[model samples]
Target: MASSLNGKVALITGAASGIGRATAVKLSKLGCALALTDVVEAGLSETAELCYTEKVIVAQLDVSNAEQCDLVVKETVEYFKRLDHVFNCAGINPTAYPILELPEGYFDKLVAVNLKGTYNVTRSTLSHLKEHADCSFVNVSSILGQRPSKEMAAYCATKYAIIGFSKSMALELGPKGIRVNIVAPGFIDTPTNASVKAGPEAVERSAQSVSLGRLGQAEEVANAVAFLMGDEAKYINGSVVEINGGLAY
Candidate 1:
């Protein structure tokens, strides 16, 4: 039996690990061909090997660069023939500290990879997606996008920007048959969160806030991304789906 996403092609950034890696694997099993990009070439290729279904192709992509964004999209189109889905999952969270205590450069770097990077990837894929008709862009925002925390100001800014960008794209591209959406995950336990887990009180506080009383898995977020990208979401767009186990509330 053919899956709903059969024959589709997808490009996922930050594909080396965490939600990105999980999304790539899920989409592949659902019958989508994959193009994987990340600054971590070794990890990206390793992820590709582990995918086990249509093996994802690894490409060194630094989404902070518009040229690399353009190249990645162009290469995916050349390889897969048509672009059907894109998941902008690449992001960074620097040291957790008060806004004033953080360096201006830290905010700059965070915005470059998180906000501007999504802009770069989504904008580059726009033309091809329009040509393909009925496609989707799923951006990985954070629960911090909707709420503020004392120690994570800059990361929050970019994630919040993703919701704004997704809404605007839905308005701009809806008529063009391109669906744009956002997935804002909260307290996800990825490698980056390992540091938080090491801090006993910090991890405890983080987990206590979630309704589920624990951290989220990367696969959980990937499931939402896959749903938004698949045909089941054909009627949905311009929506911000929160997968934080009610942590934001």
Candidate 2:
């Protein structure tokens, strides 16, 4: 498995923390050259340090900006000389609230980051991916995208849209050997959930809510992503791999 990814190039967004950070580390260990980006400059540098290799480049990027997206993709390709995989892990989840009470700017912000951001990165990388063999894309969505929650209307909408967008891309790009897939993770124990896990009872409560009786780890999702990006999953495209420990079921 490691030999297969060695020397290949991957571009990962949201590489500063959470799933993105975990994925970047995992890929680096497999000997893949990495172009890592996130809006959080410090965290991105921290992640780059953890990679601890000259094969990695860290960039501060906001996926929502089309021009920035193009620049990052172009620069990564120029640096690596080839692009094999893209992991769109940059996203935001605002505090849950009912649609009526949701802040006026909140929905727009979420849409811009979660939905448009994914599109921007994918658009910028599509042509490059098409030129490469065995290329693939893995987008990060959430369980809320598949199963809606009472106060997560905006989040759900964006995630749901990701599934649709990924499927459409899978169809359009499959012929060119460019695969696209989505990962819907649930209750991942990342910094984004620090507030939810603050109390002593928080972990237990979260565990009980899932059928697997535990919270998912960022590395666990990274495992799924790694598989999807590799030759083993070459036959898998336009599919949504739910790494939620059967939470939605």
Candidate 3:
């Protein structure tokens, strides 16, 4: 267990599964209490149970809903008495379509969940985080944010916007001892994208494109996230830590 996070309280969004669940478990192992939220209630409860912390709270949250984000944040602070860390890990899977063929509604949905969702959670937590020292926030972006793929213009746009948003927030909050950073993962094997990795041939081809010749794991990404939220990464604000298994692109 890491003493640096002992007795701290962390609010994790998208805690139902994948990177979010892995991160919640990681923090709990480090002696951090947790407030886990996701739209999937059953999975959220399962995550809460897997956490080995003294205290854990679960909420069914849709990050795309601003009111829900605010309410959840308030509930977390009230339950834990303080919030020292936040992980905006809630997001929907990307829909790939060429720019010319993409639906406007899908683009709006992507922006709502990927970009504005981050904003709502961050805004609601800022006041609470500002009061504490060594507070940190980690927003999950994707390798797609930097490297574009065909038929993913809308998804890429949303991801790219998140990086800009995180950098701006880092600048605004760094002065107050609040650090903001991003973890850009590539081809991470998570439940959210199980279909994409369903076939062995698809998985093999994906692996070959990475210098490491493998897909990244959610736990691997969570490890990087844990570091960013700890005091050891105090000087790493406004940085993007890539966990893409050395993508060939």
Q: Which candidate is the best by lDDT?
A: 3
What number of clashing residue pairs does each candidate have, in the order they appear? 0, 0, 0
TM-score of each: 0.94, 0.95, 0.96
Give Cα distance to truth, residue 227, candidate 2, Å.
0.4
Off by over 4 Å in 1: 194-201
lDDT of 1: 0.84
Give the per-residue lDDT digits (tens) of candidate 1, residues 1-249.
Answer: 677788788899989988999888888888888999998887887788778575456799999999989988898888878888889988885468786798988888899999999999988988888543668889988778988777888888888888998899999989888899999888888877744647868777888988888888889998999889877788998999988887746
lDDT of candidate 3 over 130-158, digit per residue (tens): 54488999998998898888898888888
Candidate 1, residue 157: the lDDT equals: 83
Q: What's the residue-level lDDT of 9 in candidate 3? A: 91
Q: Write the per-residue lDDT of candidate 2 for residues 1-249, one digit (tens) a residue.
A: 345777789999999889999999888887889999999988988888888467988888999899999998999989888888999999996477988999878899899999999999989988887444888999988888888788889989999999999999999888888899999988888888743547648777877879898888999999999889888898999999999886735
Model 2's lDDT to the true fold? 0.88
List RMSD in Å for every model shown.
1.7, 1.5, 1.4
Cα displacement (angstroms), candidate 1, residue 223, comes to 0.8
